[model samples]
Target: MENKKIILIVLATLIIGAGLGWLIKPTEDKTNEISENHSLESLDHQEIWTCSMHPQIRQSEPGACPICGMELIPLKKEDLGADPDSYQMSENAMKLANITSEIVGMGNASKELRLNGKIQVDERNAYSQSTHIPGRVESLSINFTGEKVSRGQTLAMVYSPELVTAQEELLQAASIKESQPELFEAAKEKLKNWKIGNTQIDRILANGKAIQRFPIGADVNGIVTEKMVELGDYVERGMPIYEISDLSKVWVLFDLYESELAWVKEGSKISYTVNSLPGETFEGTISFIDPIINSQTRVASARVEVNNKDGRLKPEMFVSGIIKNDNTDNDTQELVIPKSAVLWTGKRSVVYIKETVDGRSSFKLREIVLGPGLGDSYVVEEGLNSGEEIVTNGTFTVDAAVQLSGRPSMMSPREKETQKTNKFISVTLSEKEKQQFEPILSDYLEFKDALVADDFSSAKKLVIILDKRVKMLKTSELKEESAKIWGTFQKELIKSTQSMISSNDLQEMRNNFDELSETTIGMVNSFKLTSKELFVLHCPMANSNKGAFWLSESSDVKNPYYGSAMLTCGEVKSTLK
Candidate 1:
């Protein structure tokens, strides 16, 4: 009876344990299944963080950017079904990007060209006060640089022996009127040829004494621009004693840039002001437009005739003026935007357009055809429509983000892919090649670090190491495209090193590092990896020729060969041992 009772207890305990295990197992499985589903949802809605200044910097989690070290912001996905290349910024994003918009329409529009000019003497009325007879300056009446003088006013007294002789001949001719009529006439004409007035000749004859000196008079009623002679100074015949200009009418010379030439013409009205006379507004009519442009400044001169009866306008005084072109009849308007809206890539011009739908925003980069540029703005000839919003202030930051997102951008993504792939191939280098390439990369890193520190000595030492490594590479596994790439890189490195050795300019050295990084990245891109398993060791900072590492999937993106940056940001093919 005791054995049977123990067996019954064991059976009952086993039954209870089995029931408990079955009940808890389903709960555990359901909890695990819920956890897995949550993880999948999180993966689907993962957020990407990017920097405003360095767009190529992307982090799976929110943090600061590695390139510019700026705080990263979330990149929101657009719901507007916009083009994949387009980015729409929310109201907040627009504010952060400093995006602004303006409505463009057809209307009669004219540009006001502000020109810088100076008060100049009317060249047409300028004359030199010169003496006809060779003589010594007995007295100078005009002594200052800007003294006013009148027509026929005595500017200087010149004493000449030639004039005295001519006067004596005239007196002798006057006494012998009938005996030698031709001789008398010839002598009188000779005295007149010496510029002696009739009154002076009559005085000499009446006094019965020859005068050795004559007064040099100004030819025009004007101011003395230059005084060339002083009292007691000897002057040659026909030499100018003073430079006189008629200031009653002066010229305001306006320097017009090449673009302003189309609107400016002869007889166009202009309004001008001088800093010295603030309240007094001066007006003039354009009388002349210079046919030739100044080569150095690419500016053409426009001469405006101004009345200067008061003599307030002086030569060489700086003047500012405006020329208004009338476009009232044309009725055609041009699309214009701020000059800051355009991005110049040396070869191509670009602008970022924001597309908004249902209050959501995205950005799209558009290539623009720009016409004549006005002050602070550019006339849009094509690429943009009547209504488009553009990011004026923070386009560079946006482009940086576009590059880091592994999307097609203004820069070639394929080139970046090629660089990344070639870096992976570089890992399969022969032991000797590795030895040669290792030191080169190490030196490049040192140079980059030194540059960041602004340390010249350490940078120079690293540059020398790179120079030596490149020289060694000239004889090693350098062949085909790799050889060409390394050869070009070596040449640039040598040039940069030479620049550093010759000059102590830190900026120059930094520029050399930029070139070196570019060349090395190109060298890395020239090689292809036959085996996917092999990977190259690369320094993100040292390898970047354009100065930033960019994450991209397209091989066509601009790499070191085409852009300013060398290193590409993307998934690592294999970890560096």
Candidate 2:
């Protein structure tokens, strides 16, 4: 009977325990579920922020940018899936960056070419102060260069053995003048040949001894530019003692570049300002144009004569001149764009065209053909239409956004298929010049293969060889317009290769290789130098996903940018035959 009573007690205890556990389970699980729901909701609501100046920076919360210390802004979803070719900027970001845009229109095309030059001496009025007799310079009346001397002014004193002998002959002839009048006349004629005046000869005859030192006089009133002989320095007869230039008239020689050669004529009117003299404007007509272009400076001179009786304009003084080169072509309307809006390379002008779609402003980089420069503006020859708006101020800011977003920027030479107008270099290559690029093309292909194989050393050597071949390409036979284009392309090509040569790492060289490929593609298209089949391959994942091209002798894909990691990450973009 006691055992049965204990069993009943145990069963009752078990039943009570089970009932208590069931009662607490629902409440506990419900509380935990609520906590998890709250946590997930808070995490989902978090926003992403970035800096306008530094777009690469991304943060989960609002804060200052780590790189540039700029205030972070919320990355708007408005441009999330917008046009790939355009850079969309929020209104708030534009205001914070101090960016401004302007609407452009067609106007009368007038270009004012501004040239930098300096005041120079007129060659016509310049004269050499030369010695009539061989002598050693004893003393100089005009001690230094730029000292003024009047006509017949005693420039220097020279000890001349020839003049002393001539004077001695005069003295000897004067002693026997009564017996030999002809000899006396001949001796006086000899002194006159040495530019000796009658008074000086008479004084010498009065002294009855040869004058050891004779005075050299100036033939023209001018400033001495150069003193060729110093004290005790021997000079030859008819040798220049001083280079003197007349200040009554001067030449304002403006530096004329190869691109500006066509616009400048022999009689173009120019209005200029001297840097030394403020608030004064001078005007003159271009009197002469240099026949030969200077090899080193690659510029010619346009001479403009100016009357300077007041001696205001001095030699070596910097001057800014403007020439109004009116465009006579009435068929093409002039679309003037702000100079600040344009980002220029050697042969290209880039502008950001702004278009507002659905209240979101998008900027697209457009390469334009620049016409004549109008002081602070440029005439748009191509790549733009009237009534278009562009980024006038803070253009670089817009370009930066476009560049980071993987669109065409000033540095990236991206070619868009849908582009309305293409950049026209207006260039051609001769047969000999085309043949000259064979070794260049051969080396370039090897360089591309080296990068594809991830061989940095081989690429360095091949690029160096390619650079030499490019530099040695004969461009002298190119016509004026063609030469200008060739020079621009050549400089950019060399610059790209030189960057690779100086790179410290393989990745850096590959980055420069894209630029090299761009310059090569441009040259090939314009020059049409290919004789055999070649392929232009493009890697969409190259240049930080902005896309890059490389020349290949074969149509097979071999990615130079990604190398062994993504060897075949390219497509045959085009073929050249």
Candidate 3:
């Protein structure tokens, strides 16, 4: 009876325990099931982490960016839909590079063209003082050049036999006034014919004798610029006695070249300063522009009339002037950009335009057509509009960054320059010059191959040999522009080679290889130096972000810019066959 009672007690305890276990176990199991379902999805891309600001950093797990110290974001977050052709740079990157931007808008358009000029006598204000009656000069009132004279001022005294005779006739006629009244009037008129004023004639009659010497008076107020007569000098009627120039006004004449003719016009304002009088600025208006250009000088005179009552401005004084275009016609708006913002490639003018892409600031390369240059700025005729942002400062830095990222850039070979890559220049070369050039091309290819193989010593040695061969080339046989073109590229090529030779570092050697490669590519474009068809391969990842071009004997790309790190980082951009 005791054994059976114990068994019944144990069974009752077991029943209660089973019911508690069921209730408690379900809560843990349900929680664990939910976790297992999400575990696979969580591990999808969360295992590895990187910084959003710097994509170069990588870690096994989440932390901070080693370079920038920004909080590490999941690698999956970095797939921000960045454009392939645009350059993606974080705000931190821009700040580090000292990059700045500005909004493009139209404002008052103008340019200040600095010019050189000279002060001159106003043609209308210059005069020639002349003697009216023929005579021999007895005395001179104006003795030297630049002597001030006024209208009706006696300039010189001259003795005239004809005037003496006319005076005697007038006196004789006056003696018999009642007998011959017409004769006396005719004698007075004869003296008047010689420009003898009525006042002077009356003075002669008052003296009651024929005056031996007559005085010549100035006709206008001026300074005598040229003395045409000396003491006791003989003079004829209407003979110039002195050259006089009015000092109250002057003219400033500026030489306008053929290229600068359109910028200046009649009535344009000019602010000028004379070399003789420093720290003093003067203003004037353009009174005239020569209608015809001087054939010998290839220039036209732009005249500015200035008041010279103070007599400070002297003739032939050098003057420097500035002309600022007014752009007063506000009806049309012109787009102008800073000269620093433009990347002027021979074929295309480009700028880096800043825009928002994927909720982040991005800079894209854009080609623009440029108009006339406005001193420190350029006019944009096409490819841009108002209200857009552009990289104004550190534009080359941005382009370099974009270029290193494999985007188009100023140095990047495009379809325009590449289309004519196969068009070899028609420059004829002598057989001896061609023979000397062959080994140079061969050595260049070897130098490139050494860089591709990361052989530093071989590269240096081969470049030295290449430099010698380049120096040996003689261009005396070539003529005209062809010679100039060859000289330019050849000199550049030799310089790059010398740089590579002096560099003890492989990276530096590779850096200089960029210049060498471009020159070689240019040479290949202009000449078919080898029997084998040469290939112009471009490595977008070369030159630390600036794309580079290299010549390869084969179609396969062996990038010399990156060496073994990215031997196959490029492709054939163009070919020379």
- The number of clashing residue pairs in each candidate reads 30, 0, 3
> lDDT tens digits, residues 1-577, model 2?
9999999999999999999988866786799999999998776566778766445557888987553345788876665445556788889999998899999998777667889999988888889889987889988888789898899999889999889888988999999999999999999999999889999999999988989998898999888998888888899989998999998888888999987887788888999999888999988899899999999999999999888999988888999999987665666678898899999888888899899877888888898898877668888889988889999999999998788765668887464422111353635667776776677777888998999899999888888888887788777767777777778778988999899999988999998887788777777777786788888887765776567778888887878898877676666867977
What's the CA error at residue 433 for candidate 3, in Å? Answer: 43
Candidate 1 per-residue lDDT, tens place, 1-577, comes to: 9999999999999999999988777676789999999998886588777755445556789875554344688766552234545555578866776667544444445667788999988888898878887888888788887888888888888888888888888778878978988987898778888777778877887898888778888778877888888889888988888888888888888998877887778988888899889988777888899999999989999998888898888889999998777433475777778787788877667887766676776666788898776667777888888766777777777777666654445663212223322332232344554455655655665666566556667767777777776676744464464555556557776776666655475556654544455455544444421222223322333333223332122233222212233223222323222
Best by lDDT: 2
Q: What is the C-alpha lDDT of each candidate?
A: 0.67, 0.83, 0.80
Which one is best on TM-score?
Answer: 1
lDDT of 3 at 368: 91
Q: What TM-score do all the candidates reach, one by one? A: 0.58, 0.51, 0.53
By TM-score: ranked, best first: 1, 3, 2
Q: Which ten-residue region of model 1 has the weakest summed lDDT?
A: 550-559
Lowest summed lDDT across 10 adjacent residues in model 3 is found at 413-422
lDDT by residue for model 3 (486-575), tens: 787788888998888889889999888877877776676565465578887776456554467788889976778777665666668666
RMSD to truth, every model: 13.6, 17.2, 10.6
Q: How close is candidate 3 to the true structure, as a TM-score?
A: 0.53
